[model samples]
Target: MSIWWSLHLRREAASVPLARRLLLGTMETAGVDPDISYDLSVALSEACANAVEHGGDTPDGTPQAYRVTAYLDGEKCHIEVTDSGPGFTAPHRAPRPASSDAEGGRGLCLISELADHVQIGNKPGRGGAVVSFDKILKWRKDAPLMAV
Candidate 1:
């Protein structure tokens, strides 16, 4: 079975820092390669930011909380970013990047390009959605050994 770690927070922007730390800590604990930490951090942060922005608040204008779950399975680390707001649909894939544009709905697109795998959709049994992704760990043969 895979190992798992979870973090829950409210809809406020302040919670982002805490989320990042937890994710980094979890990855480290699971023996993820130090070299890929930056990629994981950026991808996870983007997913969590989307959750906080779109899923945490009630569609009716009330405040709500959010949750982020991360786990490691053998050679891959998985992350799920979920929220308390009503469910939403993932945006359709955009066409090739225009040569001169600077702004748009490219967050998910960028994440998909970076992460090994990406899943975005509603959380079953719960309202709202989750943006999940996984990254394959690259082991360093010369690194100090740590018992699994």
Candidate 2:
């Protein structure tokens, strides 16, 4: 089975958890393993938080928003978060191992650790940061396979 959903949210702090909660609820209902669901949820939270922080502004300084997309295909799950901010110019230095006392700069590192694959770049022709990742999904044998 395959499934996918997308959300476009204002660049606000509260939007972070809203996206995570939606992903978690969908995963739980789909019979995804709790451990995998939790890992993905935390990773999603990090991505959303980054978007809220750096979404920047539109050409006319219109309100900015971020987008989150999740896809499940029984064997794997793919997620992406995109922000309307200045995109990376140079390859980002590898995210440093966040220090215990640090309150910032850890999101990318955590996502790297959790996701099987990650790609960070500009949204084609959109001039913003795009962070996309995928994880191998482990589903219960009896879980319903719903085509999405």
Candidate 3:
């Protein structure tokens, strides 16, 4: 079986936890292993937080909303978070390690570390950052929706 969801959320601090909880609930209902669920939830939170903090305003000065999309297919899970910010300066390169004294700038690096594969880039023409990642799925012993 395959499951997928997409969310359009405002760029607000509270939205981060909301997105995390939704992902957790989906994982739990699908009977994914708890460890893997936790890791994905954390990565999702980081990505949402970045969007809330850095998703820029529109040309008319309105705050831009962001999007979160997730898919569970066969034995893999993929998630993507997109924002209307200025986008990464160097979309092709991996994010550099955050300085020890920095309070931020570590989210992308952390996402890459947690997922089996990650892609950080910009949405063509639209001009926004896109952070997408994929992870090998691990089902619980009693998974109801386990891959065939």
Candidate 4:
């Protein structure tokens, strides 16, 4: 069986945890390994946080919202977070590791570390940042919704 979900969330700090919790709950119910779920949740948090922080404003100066989408299919899970920001200056490149003393800028690097594969780019015509990742899943032996 396959499961998927999407959320069009306001770009606010509170939305980050909301997205994380939904992903965690879905993973838990699907019997995904806790460790993997944790890793994905953390990555999702970072992505959402970036959307909240950097998702830019509309021409009218109102904050634009972002979107988070997830899919669990067969033996893999895919997640994508998209924002209305200016987009990455260098598209499709793995971000450089942030300096230890830097206050921020580690999220993309951390996401790349946690997931099996990652793609950072811009949405086709809309022209916003898109961060998508995939992970091969390991299920608990007793996973209630384990894929056959």
Output the number of the TM-score-best candidate. 4
C-alpha lDDT values of all predictions: 0.72, 0.87, 0.91, 0.92
Q: Could you give candidate 4's per-residue lDDT for residues 1-148 as a string of tens digits?
A: 8899999999999999999999999999999999999999999999999999989898998889999999987698999999999897774676789998999999999999999999988888877899999999999999988988
Ranking by lDDT: 4, 3, 2, 1
**Which sections of candidate 1 miss by over 4 Å?**
56-62, 90-104, 141-148
Model 1's lDDT to the true fold? 0.72
TM-score of each: 0.76, 0.89, 0.95, 0.96
RMSD for each of the candidates: 3.4, 2.4, 1.1, 1.0
Pairs of residues at least 3 apart in sequence or in different chains that clash in candidate 4: none
Tens digits of per-residue lDDT, candidate 2, 1-148, equal 6779999999999898899999998988888888899999999999999888888887787759999999988688999999888878877765668899988989999999999998887877968899999999877656676333
Question: What tens digits encode model 1's per-residue C-alpha lDDT throughout 1-148?
Answer: 4678788777777888788887776667655677676687888777777777776556677668888888766677788888866776555343245345665555676678768888877777877877888898764454333334
lDDT tens readout by residue for model 3, 1-148? 9999999999989899999999999999999999999999999998899888889897898879999999987698999999999887773677678999999989989998889999988889978888899999999989999887
Give the lDDT of residue 49 in candidate 1: 73
The TM-score that candidate 4 achieves is 0.96
RMSD of 1: 3.4
Q: How far out, in Å, is residue 132 in model 3?
A: 0.2
